[model samples]
Target: MVTAAFPYRLYLVIAAEACAGRDLLAVAEAAVRGGVDLVQLREKQVDEPTFLARAERLAERLSCYSVPLLINDNLRVARRVGAAGLHVGNHDLPPTQVRAQWPGVGLLGYSLEYTAQLHTPEAEAADYLGISPVFRTPTKTDTVTEWGLAGVRAIRAATPKPLVAIGNIHAGNAGPVLQAGADCLAVVSAICQAPDPERAAAVLRNQIDLYC
Candidate 1:
């Protein structure tokens, strides 16, 4: 069970490719300046060495802002970089194993692809739960469920763990997602691919503050 409320209000899930040719570190730095409280480095298609290098760079950059960086499904890189946490999906490493392997990890997140996952031990072990693909989006094509607004409410009702709502989330839809019971908003293209990442992040941050 979560011992404290999840501290982050705006979570950014970023990958180098998603930045639309912009410098990943620069984009992340700007986003943090605009009020991003948490960040996750997701380098899915890269090799371990490349992923490790990127994580190392990102960890260093985020350290300056005091924003915790969560490495997505890469335990070796996470451990090597001394990341603030690790986030795993159902097909990735199990949260129970992650806990056993990295007992000192500060934050642990698990993606909820199905409501039934909430009843499992992994969900119980996570520091917070990610309600993925709250709406269908091209970024995540393999997800099993599109946990729309109703799904967010259902998950909130079932678990007290902090919920980070992801997928197709932007300023326009952020308020309703929060009202539906999400504790934080996680975004990708909305900020990464924007013409000005700082302004984009600030806009989303405002939505979170205004609605959540």
Candidate 2:
């Protein structure tokens, strides 16, 4: 069970390609400056070495601000970089196995692709639950459930773990998601591809403060 209150308000899920040609580190730094509290490095197309290098650099940079970095489905990189945590989906390493493998892991997140997953051991083992694709988006095509506003409300009623709502979330829609019971907002293009990541992040952060 999660022992403390969920502290993050605006979460950033970033990838090198998502930055729209800007330097990944620069974009991340700008986002943090604008109020992104938590970050996750999700590199699906990159090789292990590339992923590791990115994670290492990100871990080093984020450490300066005391912000936590969570690696998405990359246990080795996460462990090697001494990241604050790991976020895994249904196909990746299970949360129970991750706990057994890395007992000292400070935070563990599990993505709920289906509502049924909320009742599984994985959900029980997670420090937070990612309500993925709260709306369908090009970034995540493999996910099955859309988990629209109603879905978010239903999941919120069912689980007490902090909900991190992701997929196509931007400042315009952030307020309703938080009102629907999400504890945090996770975004990809909203910040990564924005004309000004800092301003984008700040806008989203303001929504969180205003709504939640």
Candidate 3:
């Protein structure tokens, strides 16, 4: 069995969505300035060449800030760009497989919503868990699970890994998520779509601190 690795660690991560129209690299830079500790690059429609280019640029930009840049669903790009990690879903390769392929590389996070999966042995090997749909969100239209504050707590109690609450999490709900035992909030539309991304990120950081 794949044993647990990364210790539980609290962190603020910025999730880049496919639906967001803005430039992700620029937004990532702004988020780092606003104290974001991690950034996930997730693009569904973009081709390999285009995705690689963008990921490379983003990696370069993030290098100076010491932020962990993780590619969602693409281990190749994560390897190529020298990213800090990769976040994969249930359908993707398991964290154990990822660790086998990239032996000494960085983290490998899994997306977990259900309590059962969160407590599974494979989940213990994950560097972190992205517990999603905290509130009603248009971003995850196909995903129906809405793991509210109660769900967040349930998942946290099941695993020692740091929990990152995503989907519909914004400035307003950030405090409650932390209070519910989430180590951080993974924001997508709230920061990527905001008129002032830096300001929005600042507000999220402030709220997390205030509630802590």
Candidate 4:
């Protein structure tokens, strides 16, 4: 929970698979240089050893910028590396379990699509909520109904936790999401797949500030 106290800045998380063998540090550095508030290491297909190693490196690199580094799914690696937080999906580990394992590390995030999930006790325990697939997104392996700005607005109105609009949110549509009340934006291809990630991040940050 490195930046837990200052969560207003746009949370830019880059989800890169370890299998792709991409240079995560370079990508992360560019993002941070462009005012990204947070970075999450999301490597789903990799083995434990490889995932831990990469997460460790990312955590170290982010330390310089005081950028919060989060881990997806693995609480052990998160706890070991002192990650800023952890992001858990519907099928992944529960937020309560993560809190129990690492009580000192209070920042834990959860994924939500349907508004009903936000009413649950577990959702209340999480630090933030990542409401996704505002448009059709290939990144979501699960079935995602397009929860447009209206849906995102509903989530923002319903939850006290800060909202992070994810999946298909980019420079073009980011304004509406923030207007809908999103505190942050989580993007993958919008930044990672961009020709110039640094500039892409700045554009997204500008949009975020505009709407904020």
Going through the candidates in the order shown, the clash numbers are 0, 0, 0, 0
The all-Cα superposition gives candidate 3 an RMSD in Å to the true structure of: 3.8
Q: What TM-score, over all chains together, does every model reach?
A: 0.97, 0.97, 0.88, 0.92
lDDT tens string, model 4, 1-212?
11354364656666555213557788888878987878888888778888899888888888999888889899888888888789898888888877777787657888886778887877977888888677778777684567888888787778677877788878998888878877788888777777777898899999887766
Off by over 4 Å in 2: 1-4
Off-target runs (Cα >4 Å) in candidate 1 are 1-4
RMSD (Cα, Å) of model 1: 1.7
lDDT of 2 by residue, 41-137 (tens): 9999999999999999999999999999999998999999999999999899999999999999988999999888988899999999999999999
Alpha carbon lDDT at 184, candidate 2: 91
Give lDDT: candidate 2, residue 98: 96
Model 4 CA deviation exceeding 4 Å by range: 1-8, 18-22
User: Which runs of model 3 end up more than 4 angstroms from their true locations?
Assistant: 1-20
- Flag clash pairs in model 1: none
Per-residue error at 67 for model 4, in Å? 0.3
How far residue 75's Cα lies from its native spot in candidate 2, in Å, is: 0.8
Query: For candidate 1, what is the lDDT?
Result: 0.93
**Model 4 TM-score (2 dp):** 0.92
lDDT-best of 1 and 4: 1
